[model samples]
Target: MKNESIQPPRFSSALDPIPDYLTHYFERTAGPFLNICDLDDEEVQKIREFELSNDIKWSRFKMWPEFMKSRKAADDLLMRLYEEKFQKSPAHRPVFAVLGDFHEIPCLYANPGSVRIEIADLREDEVTFMYPDHAHLIQFFDHDAPAFGVPLPENYSEERMPCWGKLFTYQDLHEIHVEYGIKKAIERCLNTPGSFVFSYVEAHIWTRDLKFTPIDHEPTGKCKKA
Candidate 1:
């Protein structure tokens, strides 16, 4: 008797659709940066086409541009919130902190203080932890890591290869849906005065036998021992 092949589930099941609130947030909060970078033309067109094909506005399609603008604003707003909330925290000082016993591997072909560009080589069994302030720490397993590319003056690349694996966060991951307005919600989250500690652990596994697991916590306080 022949054995039947098992197929993996669809991507939709693996990843939930972006909530309407987040969609609105993305449109309003991140829209400006996107507009400045000219990243919304194609997305806007797609939404329009979808609305026309479905023949249902329910709300209104005219607000698409406004939503996009709001989305871009959110990114900048989030950064400001992060800085304000944690800049004075003790954990925010060192950009990279190594846990356990490991040697600090200096870049072979690059300078320390010079413009260093790190790419998350998904191909390698390495994981990177990133903070809102552009700080990153890398943890590698018993594998040959890839080389880094030289930094370019103009037209730099922000492509990062995050370790292909599951990551767990300590903070509440809220998904919001908005039908019409999200400006107030965005403002509330962005401007509200409070501090939060976020933490995460990620497992980067190339295979069942070859894998690297490193845990990271946000807010720094979460990592403290009781």
Candidate 2:
């Protein structure tokens, strides 16, 4: 039988702008680091109330907590492994290895004192890298269009851009990973030297699906089943 999947809807520059309050809430409550350590019942309840009051679907905001926890746990476990097995201090290492195998990258061992390793939570379609003073949020979107395919007026760049893809459902993200092999691909990227940071690196990979779409034809219903 021929494949009959529906192509996911393309975001045009026509959608309504996301509210600033939602954006601020996400930034403050669902962080990659701070949330993991400081998230509490009260905060979660407050967010739940906000979402309900604003008519925002809870699913859109739910992943942040799980993603934050998973990433922190992974980082903690890896750090422990480094401390016990390598007997080396991560503080001494400024460069961090992400994805792939550390052995394949000669540069990794050459600067053990300067290298820290981390495995990202591929489930989280977005990652934010923050230092003591600087921060950057990297979002993953469909490869066919500009990162975050949602449509918005050009003038709405600052407001609309920040909200782009923040509305993506977890299922949408999962489909992207399945279709693109994003998780494994990122691991491979980490293994390859020069593909990622070599010193004091804070890298975020936004995995894009490689599937092709026909302009005139819509994807079959099967595609939407994912």
Candidate 3:
């Protein structure tokens, strides 16, 4: 019996590319390589004050405190995990990207754009990290990870975690693919429509600087038409 009442996931598409590379999506206006935690306390306070004065309801200003806490907790855990694995600390607030081509990730932003970067593009000295899904949200809220969307497979283990409980390096990309490749990651999201969690595998690029394409903003939002 066909259950047409169960609407399919909105973002997954037959045309979504299963690319050989990764992509960093951002607001073209802001350009790429920006991290919110980079802001100093005073600067953040100024923005918070400004936003509250302007009467913006549920603004990022109001959420800054808890968000920062979550972000820092995740970042600290990532640093510890990476250092333990690689014998050195990775740079704080590395640029965020996702393995393969995922259209839904970019749509989370107000003005989305992407620049594709591949493993070959990285310098030999550069270090990178990856997780099967968004690192911060998953790592910080691990208690809710396994049951995020559909119930996880009965055999789910650390080797098959769907979120940030695990971290991988560029050297581990091949092994990662064998464990949870692009196709599987996409399918996980597709299985649960109307939920953005576990949408794609996240790749954290660590470098002092990076080269990126110019502003290529595509106006889209989950709540509004593109």
Best by TM-score: 3
Q: Put down candidate 1 lDDT per residue, 1-226, tens digits, no spaces.
A: 1133222111111012311110000122122112222346786666555544442312124333343444334323333333444453222111221111111111110111111111222222221222211211111111122211111114322333221111211121112112211222332333232211011111211112212222121122221223
RMSD of every candidate to native, in Å, equals 22.1, 22.5, 9.5
Give the TM-score of each candidate: 0.22, 0.22, 0.65
Between candidates 1 and 3, the one scoring higher on TM-score is 3
Taken over the whole model, the C-alpha lDDT of each candidate is 0.23, 0.28, 0.53
State the lDDT of candidate 3 residue by residue for 1-226, as single tens digits. 1222222123433213433455676655566776656878786566556645543323444544455555555555656766777687776656777665556665444445677565576763354545444344333346332222233345766555543355666556555555555446656665466545456666777774664433233333342333
In angstroms, give how far residue 35 of model 2 lies from its true place: 3.3
Candidate 2 C-alpha lDDT tens digits along 6-28: 32223311111211110001122
Q: Number of the top candidate by lDDT?
A: 3
Order of all candidates by lDDT, from best down to worst?
3, 2, 1
Q: Tell me the lDDT of candidate 3.
A: 0.53
